[model samples]
Target chain A: GIQVEQSPPDLILQEGANSTLRCNFSDSVNNLQWFHQNPWGQLINLFYIPSGTKQNGRLSATTVATERYSLLYISSSQTTDSGVYFCAVGSNYQLIWGAGTKLIIKP
Target chain B: SAVISQKPSRDICQRGTSLTIQCQVDSQVTMMFWYRQQPGQSLTLIATANQGSEATYESGFVIDKFPISRPNLTFSTLTVSNMSPEDSSIYLCSVVPGTGAYEQYFGPGTRLTVT
Candidate 1:
């Protein structure tokens, strides 16, 4: 099994501010994805970056597979971005998840 | 991407009762997975449901406690047997379509609260 670790266990920022979350893996992975679990409990797929970088709206992510690390950036954050961000990795058939970074955006 | 629909989006059940969550995928898939996310916790893999065969449970999950069934390629069900308050969490179903690649699409999820 692979180990996933997320940094900045907790983060609080103003609604208009920006922040970055990092995820580190213990072993090589064939697949990697970033997910945002909203307050309503729906896990929204943020990025499917096994390597390289990707952007969508105000959110973006970069995965350095060789370094075994990935980063998620939220620019001009909104109150709706408040929730837990998880980094999941797949090796064989199963995916291993990180504890996640809890983000709180204040108005 | 595959579209998945899960039944009983949310439920509150007695501690002794059981709840079965159904996952339906718009596209046929050979592999389906069940996951549990405790409050404020990371998602944990419950088991891997393979069509025409029994599911393979994770380390902490057992078939007797969380029975899973995959009768076909596009649907599966996971039953939380003899539920407890600790079982209160979001149960999500995910599937991987095609071969060679391993991208997964998840369903909305079922929120369960046992008291």
Candidate 2:
């Protein structure tokens, strides 16, 4: 089984501030996804990046497969961007999830 | 991406009672899974909903307690039996569209509260 660990277990920043969350996995994986669990408990897929970088709006993610790590960046954050961010990685089928990074944006 | 929906968005159950959750996908997917998210905790894989046969559950999860049924490719159900307060959490279902796409999409989740 692979271990997925996320950094900054808890984060608090003012609105408009930027933050970066990291996910480190113990083994190589073929699938890696970043998800945002909103306050309403809806899990939204942010990115499906097994490797390389991708950007969507003010949020972007980069995964270094060789290094077994992924990074999620939130720039000029807004109040609505407060929630838990989780990273799930899987090799063939089963996925292991991280504890998640709880981000709070204060207005 | 597929539109996943869960029935009985939220429910309150008494101890010793059981709750069955329904997950429906708009499209046929190759894989369906059940996950549990404890209060203020991360997600944990419960089991993989196999379309035809018994489900493959993860360690710490058992078939007797969390029975799963995938009657077809687009629908599945997870039943939490003999529930207790500890079973109070959000249960979510996810799917892999397959067809060469491996990205997983999640359902809205069912929030259960046990007394």
lDDT string, candidate 1, A1-107, tens digits: 68899999999999999999999999988799998988888788898889999999999999999999999999999999999999999876578999999999999
In model 2 chain B, where is the ten-residue run with the lowest total lDDT? B96-105
Off by over 4 Å in 2: none
What C-alpha RMSD separates each model from the true structure? 1.3, 0.9
Q: Which residue segments of model 1 deviate by more than 4 Å? A: none
- Cα displacement (angstroms), candidate 1, residue A65, comes to 1.5
Best by TM-score: 2
Per-residue alpha-carbon lDDT of model 1 for B34-91, expressed as tens digits? 9998887899999999888889888999999999999998899999999999999999
Give the Å shift of residue B13 in candidate 1: 1.2
For model 1 chain A, the run of ten residues with the poorest summed lDDT: A87-96
Q: Residue A9: error of model 2 in Å?
A: 0.7
Deviation from native of the Cα of residue A27 in model 2, angstroms: 1.1
